[model samples]
Target: MGSRVMPQGAQDISDPFIERHLVIDTSKVNRNAERGGFTNREQNGVTDQVSSPRRSEIVNRSLSAVKSFGNDDIDLEGGDVEKDRDKTIRGSRIVKVRNQAVLSGLAYCISSCSMILINKFVLSSYNFNAGISLMLYQNLVSVIIVSILSLSGVISTEPLTWRLIRVWLPVNFIFVGMLITSMFSLKYINVAMVTVLKNVTNVITALGEMYLFKKHHENRVWAALFLMIVSAISGGITDLSFHAVGYSWQIINCFLTASYSLTLRRVMDTAKQVTKSGNLNEFSMVLLNNTLSLPLGVLLIFVFNEVDYLSTTPLLRMPMFWLVITASGFLGLAISFTSMWFLHETGATTYSLVGSLNKIPLSVAGILLFNVPTSLQNFASILFGLLAGVFFAKAKMREKSQS
Candidate 1:
């Protein structure tokens, strides 16, 4: 009844499908061998009594048996092919991630070094005494750019509520202090010594971590910190153009920098609670910091009497001056963006490592580009300080991995 009701061609099509999968099993073959139906003659010591046609027939059956085993192997080979394809896909993704990390790190290094050099040119070379105004203008540029990007949906940022602003106010104040002191120090100090002196920030941060967060450090970390101190002192002693005011400002900058880091870490969670998304991204932080700084910066301009200087300075009349300062502003934004990008793509470990290594080229470029006075001893001390930073980063990485 089933055959009678089937379609005209259904039986023929179904026959091959069933036959392909219903090949002879190994157990059936073994049973046949025990029954002496198709056994190997040599294994049983049987004589060649069969005719030549019969022998040819046995050989054909043996070939069919081997082909059956090959069928199973084909399925396994198909699985291996699938695995290889997956591996290829994963390898391509990793390459793409690595490329992104490299690009971000390079952008960070270029923007960072360029920002410092440009600031030095405007402050020292151009003899511009208005550091606060410069900081204000650069930050204004950042605020404008970030606002545009956020509105255009090119990046995501948390909405800034008053609560969030209040939560971040303390950190922003320290941020202002850090930036102002850094600018004052850079105005009088050569770039190389400034870079070396900045190493003290790490020591301060480590101590802050120990005292504030109740964290402990490995002995290797302490050793690296001590080395950093030695290098800073040695560098200062050998500096050919040492300025007491510069050194004092730098010491304050270090403390403020450390304070900014510690305070930001503590306040971040509280700030997030006030945000619409309950998450504050790097862009939001950049926008918030720059926006909040504007009013404070204005007040500072009045206190420092920079408005009169800005009004009278002939450098403002030159289109070239505007171009340079504007470029520095863009580079300032680039530094912020690329630093976050590098950290996101490669994690903090690689970011810290690259940052440590970046000081070397910056030091050399600062001396050569500005022709800052330097002796062999000062250069050695700078190198030592830079190496100490690298050693510190390595120690922290090892300690993190072990923990």
Candidate 2:
């Protein structure tokens, strides 16, 4: 060995060194067999033995991590599914609301048309205070109808009290004014002209809002208002045929109607407050207003010498009269419900826009059904009326934005 210790070829190992290496490898193999019963291979040689319990714990931890990851993925997928379902429900609700608004607008237009047709065809056939008497009878009939509905639990009852009465008094006056002025105007003017002239209320409402309510408007709204006014005036003038008394009554109608609309907005707001306070119900307010008007309507009939025309037998005998009265009452109730529904669904501006469109059909119907004449001047009046409505709408929109 001393002779060959000759560098051991730098590759050959001595007996003692090789024996020691073998012993170490043997010990490692035995330890692996005793513990895990296996050994891991390595590039250099062999890896040290790992414990069975420790290896099992390591494997278990990895499996737990995988399972947790799978659970997290499942939770995320479930959340995504719920979110999608909620979005689908919300979209459906929006569609339902839009449909309701359209239906309400159509109902309002139909009711208005029915009223006009009845006034033109049926009431015109009767004599003095015929319109007034018809109105009075209709109110009485309405009271009965409403009372029946209330008793039947179809309509909810409201309390009667001074505070509630006072709040609605002004609104009731405005309502009466609306009915009276429109009827009076119809008596003097043709339906087409009346429809066209009604547009003027838009301008009055705008002016009232600015002067009385001190509302500010946007430039676009002002521009639209101007355009609407121009359109109405042009339309009216183009279709004009002068009937001084008719025109006068129409103007009065416009004023009264504008007042009614403006006053109603305030009254409705106040009524809501009173309702919340448990002082009144809307149905009760309606009943009280009509009941109080019973006396006023009767007095007016006598004052206007319309009592002579008011024959209980003749009125009852006339099927057409009853039809008109029935139609009018139904229309009135429908208008109330539809207008409220429209406002709830689409807001005031949309309501006004639909109202403006109503004139077109009404005017056409007036001309075709009632033979109401149209001229350049009348057209201009229509244009002006339309313009006024547009302007009023703009003013309202601007005020809302500012607020």
Most TM-score-accurate candidate: 1
Clashing pairs in 1: none
What Cα-based lDDT does every candidate model obtain? 0.73, 0.55
lDDT of 2 at 50: 46
How far residue 319's Cα lies from its native spot in candidate 2, in Å, is: 1.9
**Distance from true position, residue 254, model 1, in Å?**
0.6
- For residues 87-135, could you state the per-residue lDDT of candidate 2 as single tens digits? 6766777677668777877886776566676666654545424566666
Candidate 2: stretches off by over 4 Å: 1-95, 125-129, 166-171, 218-241, 260-281, 312-316, 380-384
Supply the global lDDT for candidate 2: 0.55
lDDT, residue 374, model 1: 90
Candidate 1: list runs displaced more than 4 Å.
1-95
Task: Please give each candidate's TM-score.
Answer: 0.78, 0.67
Tens-digit lDDT string for candidate 1 (261-377):
677668877887889887766577778887888999999999999999999999999999888888887887776667656655766566667767887898899999999899999
Error of 1 at 283 (Å): 0.8
